[model samples]
Target chain A: MTELDRVIHEPARLRIVALLAGVEEADFLWLLRESALTKGNLSSHVARLEEAGYVAVEKSFRGKIPLTLLRLTDAGRSAFGGYKRAMKAVLGKG
Target chain B: MATDAQLRDLEQRPQRYWNADGIPELVMGLVWIIWGVALLVGEALPPGRGQQGYWMVMPAILVLSGFGANWLIKRLKERLTYPRAGFVTYREPGRSARLLSAGVAILTAATLAFLIVTGRQGGTEQSAAPAIGLILSLAFLVAALRQRAPHYLALAGVALMLGLAFGALRLGWDAINWMLVLLGAAAALLGAWRLARFRRCNPPSVEHHP
Candidate 1:
């Protein structure tokens, strides 16, 4: 497996990247709801992905509420595509 | 943890959402051409008073309205601030609904044409176009309601057309002219309101890339 695949193989990080990849950007609350992850768990995983350059985070205030928007980076997209292909190949479905 | 070097690399990548100003321009240009053609044809072709000439103006007015709408949409796009979302997926309307709407639009245009051609002589002959338009409109309203689609604009269009047709037949040509003017004003007002709402909802973004 490629090094990128290794990074994305973690269950929490994988789910975080997958959700962000499908949208242009998503609110932190939306990601939590969709992934069914606890606030702390989701935040930790998001931080890891953000550190890995798989996601970009924008923190701002929507009215009085603090909003965190997450977007997948180009590297994240390429890595995700590669991981999927590698998985398919391993499963003999590619 | 990812390194600072990685974050810089990620930031260099391009964005996905591109401005779509050209699409509105193309649509507006096409509407203008159609309106120009209709106006020229209406003027060149001589028909009886309140006949073909009058009916031809309908297409011209519709095309101009379309042009104005496109222009307004283009202006609104410039001010949209929200982070772009992917296309929203909605349930498709049933086959019956689609067919009914298409049928009504076609029938309404056809009936209007027929009345303009046959009733040009200013005779006392009863025109069926108005009745047909009303029935077609009702059918469309039912279909739109069944599918839970936005039918206000369709409802308004149908109502205006039917009102004009009825006024023309019952009251006379002068009443029909007044009704058309009222419809035009209403449509313009609605279009302006929608444009304003669109602009307010969407704000400009400096970070977006093509």
Candidate 2:
């Protein structure tokens, strides 16, 4: 598994990555509410991962309302795949 | 599964987002100018202090404070963690339309109010500075709250308005001007610190959707 894969192993970040991995982009509020994580918690994790080039954050407005959207990186994708494979291998299912 | 792959793909790309910092400042500055003009007119039509020449200082203070706030914020952009959030493509405002409308509304109301009230004008040709500043600052506050944007600019506006209004109403005109100066200085200093912090961390480039 790659270094990017290892970072996503954290449960909360993994969940974040998992959520973003599924949708084109997830609104920050939605993610925070859905993930049940505080702003600071999510931000710190996202910041670390983003700095590591595993995720991207976007900021814009919807009408007058500000929105934040988060997405993963290509490296993140590769790592996530490896993580899945490693998990499967450990489970003796692959 | 196909769904799993889709989710993974979604995570890997950048998305577009918006930053409201510029718009708020722009609105705040415009409103400040309007308030200054109103104060000048109000001072002109006053019942007292009409050629006292002391009232002239109010508009000067307003102009200086408003411009100073804007300048400080712009210069200190590097220190603050200004909020930048993403909106869906359908959510973006029509190019500059809402802003224009808001500006027109504010100007019209302020102008009408100044003309109608000051015309009868029995009070101590009191510096309209406090009232005008309050209204203008409130405009920024309303915009910031409505937009669900960052609070720094709005907070600064509120603080200035409150300081000036309360100071003028209670302590007297001289106190209000000095209060504004102090408030401006504080905002400038805080903005500088935030800008310094912002500079240390390069913000992520937001993507444009649609």
Candidate 3:
């Protein structure tokens, strides 16, 4: 059995990563809404993912309002894909 | 942990997000209405070089209107939608996919235009109106299925009914022109209503500085 990627194995982070995989890039608020995570909780998880080289974060302004944008890095996508395959294998559905 | 199926469903979120505020529908509705009106205006013109000139300029006007609609939708979404719902950009299609789409669109448009023109000139039974209806209905049906929006189903029905009604009337160019105008009006109103409801339900989420 292939070991799962620990960074994305956490429930909250898994949801966050799943949301990011759907779009090219999304703002902080977008991720927060979709993932149903508290603002602070999402921020912390995103920061951890950034440290893991799984997600890329870019800070920019939409006019005067500061926005934090996020996307799954290439490594993150591959990790998520692997995670899915592993789950499928475990479930006897692969 | 979500099963693999749920994760696949989550991947469709962006498409739903894009359709949430009805901006795309509104834009498409406006395009149909504008084109219908332009056709009527061209018909009303007295025959001369001016009429010929209007026909030539009509395509340019439609192209410009398309660009205008694109700009308006983006501006509106940025201010009205993103602040409330959230902001996400979808991936663009690959070059080959885009080229294929463009080719098909051109071919389809050319064929439809040719049929309508020749049918009118030959004074044949006006079958083009029903064809237009069928095409528009299919488009709305696709939207209904993809966006999970019930209103689009009504739109599909309206288009089909209008097309059949016009075809039955066999009133030549006038029937088709009127059908286009009515369909456009219905779509625009529906889109506007959906947008208003979306705005009412979702007050822009208070921006929390992360």
Candidate 4:
């Protein structure tokens, strides 16, 4: 039996990673809108994903306002792909 | 754990984002308007043998519209969509999509060349309208189906109708120009409506926390 990626196993994080996988990069508000996670909760999960080297976070300013952009790293993409395969296999649908 | 439906929705987020702003449609509308103007001008002042160089402006309009619209759309996105949705850079589609796009481009070129050659030989104004209409319909249909965008389907229907009116009914040249102008107006309105709705749905986030 193949084990799931623990980092992406959590429901909220799984959703976040899945959303990020579809785009090259997304900003914090886009993630918030899509994931429906609270500001603090979303931030923490993004930080954890960043720490695991699965995501890259960049801080920049659009005008005077700060913008936080998040992207799935190569590792993140690979992990997400693996996670999907594992899920499908476990569901007996692979 | 996310449900299967939830994951599928997540996978489609980028496609939604790409269409959300409606900038592409607006740009396309402007391009059509320009082409209509070019066609009308060519009709009003028929290019003579020595002055056939005037017809070259048609291709120039196309090339410039492509580059200019891209730049304008980027700037518009920066102002309109970036603040509210927080910007997202989308990835290109897979290899199969690219190959399909190339195939379509080749087919369109061949079809357009055939129409132009046939029209010149026949000395008919009607030939160009159907060709343009067919191309527009195919482009809209492809985009609509691929993106699951119902609005584009409406555009495709309109394009087909206009094509039939021009080709089958043998409508005059001015009628084709007028129809294209009307389509451009409709596209602009659609884009504006979608842009307003997108803004209302996704208000800009207030927090600037890093």
Candidate 5:
């Protein structure tokens, strides 16, 4: 059985990364809504993932509006994939 | 620990959100209507300089319609959907989905060709009628299932009924052409209605992203 990465084991971050896995990139607001996380909660979880190099954040402007874009880095994708396999392995035994 | 299906469902949420507005339906409906009209025009032209030339036009029309539909969807989404919902880029469909689409296209084309060729021996309208209904309804049914929109199933039922009526009446060679036009128009109308409803419910965002 593969070991799960600590960065993605937390439920909130897990949900965030799982949602991001479906798309190429999503704006910050989109992630917040989809994750059903409060603005502050989402921000901190995103920050923690960012610190671990599991998520990449780009702050930019779309016209005058400040836009924050989010996507999983390659490392993040690998970690998520590993996490999924480990969980599946455990589930199969159970 | 969340199961794979749970995570997969979570992954699918963003895609479902993007599609909730039914912008793709509007694009698809318009494309169908335009293509139907172009085919009708081809059938109308007399066989000679214009008709021979029109064969060339059919390919061009198909190509142009593809480009136009692609552009229209992006423009419509940017203006109507993106702001209200925020931005998400869906993953391109995987190989199996692409293969399924291609298979459907080929099957439809083959079936239509068979019907037309066989009908030419008797009557074009009579033979093609049931196939038209089957094809149209199936197309709509697939759309309904994929989009999880029940209205498409209703549309499919309508298409099926119209096809049977057309076959029973045997309205002649041009009957299927008119049916196609009606199908296109009906699709466009339904899509527009859905789009209007979507707009009414979800106003544009007032907040800038953090």
Candidate 6:
């Protein structure tokens, strides 16, 4: 049996990755709104994902306000893809 | 763990993000309105250099309206949506999306070319507006079905109905011109309605970087 990717198996990280996968890049605010996570919790999960090389983070300012952009890395996309396949195989239903 | 259906839903969510602001509809409305007015004005003008310049306005409207709408939408989102929902730069659609778009474009061109040739060969004067409009309406219908957006589907239905009416009635230039103007007005009104509702639902919140 192909084991699930531990990095993507966590529900919160999975949700975050899933959202990022759908778009080119999403800013911190967008993620925050979509994920409905508190600042601290979302940051920790994002930091962990970044550390694992699954997501890239860029910080900049939109005018005076700071904006943080997030995108799924190639590694991240591959990991997510692999995780999905593993899940599907485990479930044995398409 | 989310169910398979739930996962599928998540995957498809980004599409709903595209017209969240209703700005695209407003832009399209403006374009059609201008095109209709140009056609009407062209009808009255004498056949000369002046008429030629008048017809040229259609292309100018298309290009300018397209670019201007994009710029306006971006600015509006920056002010309205960004503060409330937060900012998101959506990922470009993948290869399949691009291929599908290209296919649609080619099909549309082919259909138009066929219409023009057949009409001319048959020695029948066929108005380009109704034919083109029907094709576009069908295209919108297909898109709405794919996206599963009810509002878009409704618009598609209206367009389809109008296109059929135009063809069946063998409408003249004047009738077509008025129809275009009405269509544009309807689109703009619908957009405004959606925009107001969207604003009510999504109130801007203080930036929280989480």
Among these predictions, the greatest TM-score belongs to 3
Error of 6 at A48 (Å): 2.1
- Clash number for each model: 7, 29, 0, 0, 0, 3
lDDT of 5 by residue, B1-210 (tens): 677778988887875775577677667777877777778888888889989988887878888888888888888887888787778877789999999989988987797777777788766557576777887899788877775667788779878987888888887656687677777677777878888898898788877454
Tens digits of lDDT, candidate 6, B1-210: 766676666666666666776766776787778878877887889999988887777667766876787788778777777777777776666799999988977987687568657766874433655665666577678777777666776676667667667666775546567668877877788778887888899886756564
Q: Report clash pairs, candidate 3.
A: none
lDDT of 1 at B23: 30
Question: Each prediction's DockQ?
Answer: 0.07, 0.08, 0.73, 0.70, 0.69, 0.66
Strongest candidate by DockQ: 3
Flag regions of model 4 displaced more than 4 Å: B1-5, B49-51, B92-100, B119-135, B172-179, B208-210
Q: Tell me, by lDDT, which candidate is best.
A: 3
- Please provide, for model 5 over A1-94, each residue's C-alpha lDDT reduced to its tens digit, 9 standing for 90 to 100: 5567888988999999999998988898788777888989899999999999989999988887778889999999988888888887777742
Model 5 interface RMSD over true interface Cα atoms = 1.4
DockQ head-to-head 2 vs 6, winner: 6
Docking class of 4: medium
TM-scores, all models, native as reference: 0.38, 0.34, 0.91, 0.87, 0.88, 0.85
Q: Which 10 consecutive residues of model 5 chain A have the lowest summed lDDT?
A: A85-94
Off by over 4 Å in 3: B121-125
Candidates sorted on TM-score, descending? 3, 5, 4, 6, 1, 2
Q: In model 1 chain B, which range of ten residues has the least summed lDDT?
A: B12-21
The docking quality of candidate 4, as DockQ, is 0.70
Model 6 residue A45 lDDT score: 95
TM-score for candidate 1: 0.38
Cα deviation at B179, candidate 6, in Å, is: 3.4
Per-candidate TM-score, chain A: 0.92, 0.86, 0.96, 0.97, 0.93, 0.96
The C-alpha lDDT values of all candidates are: 0.54, 0.54, 0.85, 0.82, 0.81, 0.76
Residue pairs with clashing backbones, model 5: none
Residue B193 in candidate 5, Cα distance off native in Å: 1.8
Ranking by DockQ: 3, 4, 5, 6, 2, 1
